[model samples]
Target: MQDVIIVGGSFAGLTAAMQLGRARRKVTVFDTGLNRNRYADHAHNIFGHDGTPPGELLAAARQQVQAYPTVQLVPAKAQLVSGGPDDFRVTTTDGETVSGRRLILSYGIVDDFPAIPGFAQCWGKTVIHCPFCHGYEVAGTRWGLVYSSPMSLHGAVLYANWTDDITLFLDGHAIIDEERHKLEKRGVRLVDGKLRTISHDAGRIASVTMDDGTEIALEALYAHPRNRPSADLHEQLELDMGDTPTGTMIKAGDMQATSRPGIYVAGDLATGMHSVTFASNTGSLAAMGALQSMLV
Candidate 1:
């Protein structure tokens, strides 16, 4: 049995593997190779590797983790998880079964893209989610906040720091007068209409078209779409879950330990703040938690 089996190979999974590998613990990482940031041209806000392509950073991490003989990275998806503490079993897509003393879930989440035309093409480019991640890059540009939920009101207010030219697209959601006044008080333009299409020039948004034939020019649009865990193992394992504005995540403690023993979670799967740095940090903490459990 391996010391640990991590079900994801992006930022969080790789970081967990590195921590275990450095301690000479046998660990295996199963990755489907689909990272959430794959569409992003470059990753920002990550120290020491700011502006680096997301793929490049992950490649470097894979290489670093491979230096230890105890670690192995497998390009496969985890199909199911079973067993219990110190004897967990993971079945992969390739008809193979791997057992480990601990399991780290960093499979990440899948963004539920809106059905609007050109939205997917512009995602991670002229369309974004986090202001801190891509805000500065489009500072002073015409910005639009496509409201997905009431939680998005917080995003509209936070975005004011990056640009004053902000428009909030209600997208079929009703807003109370109090909230409307609050947004308008901050110089944010409010538009109550369902988005019909996003017109972009080569994956860079130029404008958004509403169902009522209203067209609003935009340099960039921000949206927080609901997401679900990439892997379905959470249900099979019966791990405790919590809800985030974007999706349902595994509930982990300070050390990234899930309510279930021998299972830990990290990355976007465990928190609302989705960033490369936070993912890596949580992975490290999950490793420490797993190690502590094993040592005791």
Candidate 2:
């Protein structure tokens, strides 16, 4: 049996495998290669490697990790997870089963895109979620915010750091008078009504059309759509879960240990705040936790 089997090889899984590999522990990583950031042209805010293409960074990391003889990287989707503790069993899309003493769930989340046309097309370019990820590129330009949840009210506050020209689309969600007045005082233009479409040229957004056919031109639009775990393997394992502002995540402790023994979680699957640095950090923690447990 392998020392550890990690699901989701994008960021967290790969990092976990690297840590375990360095310690000469046998590790297997399953990846389907569908990264959430695949739509983004370049990733930012990562120290030293900032502005690197997301795919390039992952590819390099995968190559380096595979250099370890104890590490095996498989290009397959983990379909089901069973067993528990030091005897966890994982069945993949290959119809083959792999067992390991410890399990690390690093599968990321999936964003539920809006039905608005051109939204997905412009997702990473003109339509974005994290300002820290794509803010600097469009700073000092016409910016728009789609109020998806109460948590979104603070988006204008955050955007104010990068640009003064900001418009918040209530999009059928009610805003309290107090908060509304605060936004107005901050020079934020608030627009009501739901979004019907996003007009773009070559994946660059030009304007957003409201349900009533009102068109608002914008350089960039920010949205926080609800997301769920990319795969249901966590559910199949029946690990404890918790809800975040945007969606749900698997529950893990300080060491990345799930409520269930021998099972760990890391990266976006365990935290609401996502970044490449955070993913690698949590992955290392999960690996160390599992490694330390094996000694007992």
Candidate 3:
């Protein structure tokens, strides 16, 4: 049995592997090669490698981690996860099986895009999320926020950190006059009616078309679609779930340990504050926790 079987091989998984690898522990990472930020062009706010493509950063990390000899990155989805804690077993779709003493579930999440035309295509480009991650580049450009919940009001206010030219699309969500006044006071324009579609040129926003046929020109449209784990390993394992501001996540605690002992979780699956830095930090924590748990 391997020392650890990490269910995902993206930032969190790779980071965890590196730590465990340094400790001379056997680690196997299963990956489907689809990272949440794979669509993003340049990953910002990442220290040292600021503005590097997400894929490139991960590629370099994988290369470094694999050099440890004790770690293997398997390019396959973990089809079935059975057993638990020190006797955990994982099977790939092709029926290959591997058992590890500990598990790390960092499969990440998937964004639930609205049915607005041209929206999903523009993800990671003109239409985006996380202003702190993509904002500096577009600061001073026309920005639009697709209101999803009351939490969006917080986004509208927080966005002043980047740009003042902001429009909060009602998108069929109701807002009280007090909220509207506060938005207006911040120089935010409120667009009424449900969204019809988004017009874009190769992921570059052109304008947002409304149900009433009104069109608002925008450079970037920010959306907070609810997110969920990209895989079902957590559920199949019956790990406890948690809620984030924008969606559901796997509940994690000290050292990034999950509700199930020997099952550690990190990155977007375990936290709402999604970012590369946070992913790396949590990943190291989980690795240390798992390593310590393995002590006799």
Candidate 4:
């Protein structure tokens, strides 16, 4: 049996595997290669590697982890997780089953963008979710906020701090009266209409089309897309999930230990504010926790 089996070989999984391997622990990392930030052209605000493409960063992480002979990186989606405590069993998409003394779930979340024309095409470019990720590029530009949930307003308010040119689109969603008034008072232009589609040119969004056939020019847009966890196996594992501003994240303790004894969650699957740095840090913590438990 491996010392640890890490599901989802993204930033978090790779970091955890690196820590465990350096400590002379055998580790296996399973991944499907569907990282949430694949659409981003480049990642910002990461120290030492500012403006680096996310794919490149992950590639370098994988290379660094594999330098230790104890770590094995496998390309497969973990489909089933069973057993518990210091002993766990993981089955992957390829029907391969592996057992480990400890399990680290670095599985990320899936982003479900709005079903509007050009929305996905412009995502991570002219359209983004996190202000810290894409705010500086479009600072002071004609930015628009499309409301899909109550959190959309919060995103609008936050984006306004970065740019004076901000517009809020109700997008056929109900907004509370007090919230509407507050938004207007804060200089956020409130537009009441259904968004029919997004018009774009060659992956760059130009404007949003309303149901009334009116086009609102937008240099950039912000949205809060619904997020789903990377694995449905969490339900089978009987882990406690809690609602977050982004979506449901598996509730865990300080060491990334879930209520389930041997099952640990890391990265976006455990919490929101999904960033490379946080995920990597959590992964290392999870690995250290598992290592300490093994020693005991």
Which stretches of candidate 1 lie above 4 Å from their native place?
none
Compose the digit string of candidate 2's lDDT tens values, residues 220-281.
99988899999998888788999999999999986999988999999999998988889989
Tens digit per residue, CA lDDT, model 4, 1-296: 99899999998899899999999999999999988889998998888998999999999998988899999999998998899876799998889999999899888999888788888999888888878988898898899988867777787788877898899988887777999899889899988888888889876889999989989999898887889897887888888999987689989897899887777888888887688889888998999988987898
In model 4, the Cα lDDT at residue 175 comes to 78
Please, what are the lDDT tens digits per residue for candidate 3 over residues 153-230?
A: 999999989999999998888899999998998899999998898998889899998999998999999998888899
lDDT of candidate 2 at residue 258, scale 0 to 100: 93
- Each candidate's number of clashing pairs is 0, 0, 0, 0
C-alpha lDDT of all candidate models, in order = 0.93, 0.92, 0.92, 0.88
Residue pair clashes in candidate 1: none
CA displacement after TM-score superposition, residue 11 of candidate 1 (Å): 0.5
Model 3: lDDT of residue 295 = 99
Model 2, global lDDT: 0.92
**Candidate 3: residue 286 Cα off by (Å):** 0.5
The TM-score-based order of candidates, best leading, equals 1, 2, 3, 4
C-alpha lDDT (0 to 100) for residue 176 of candidate 2: 87
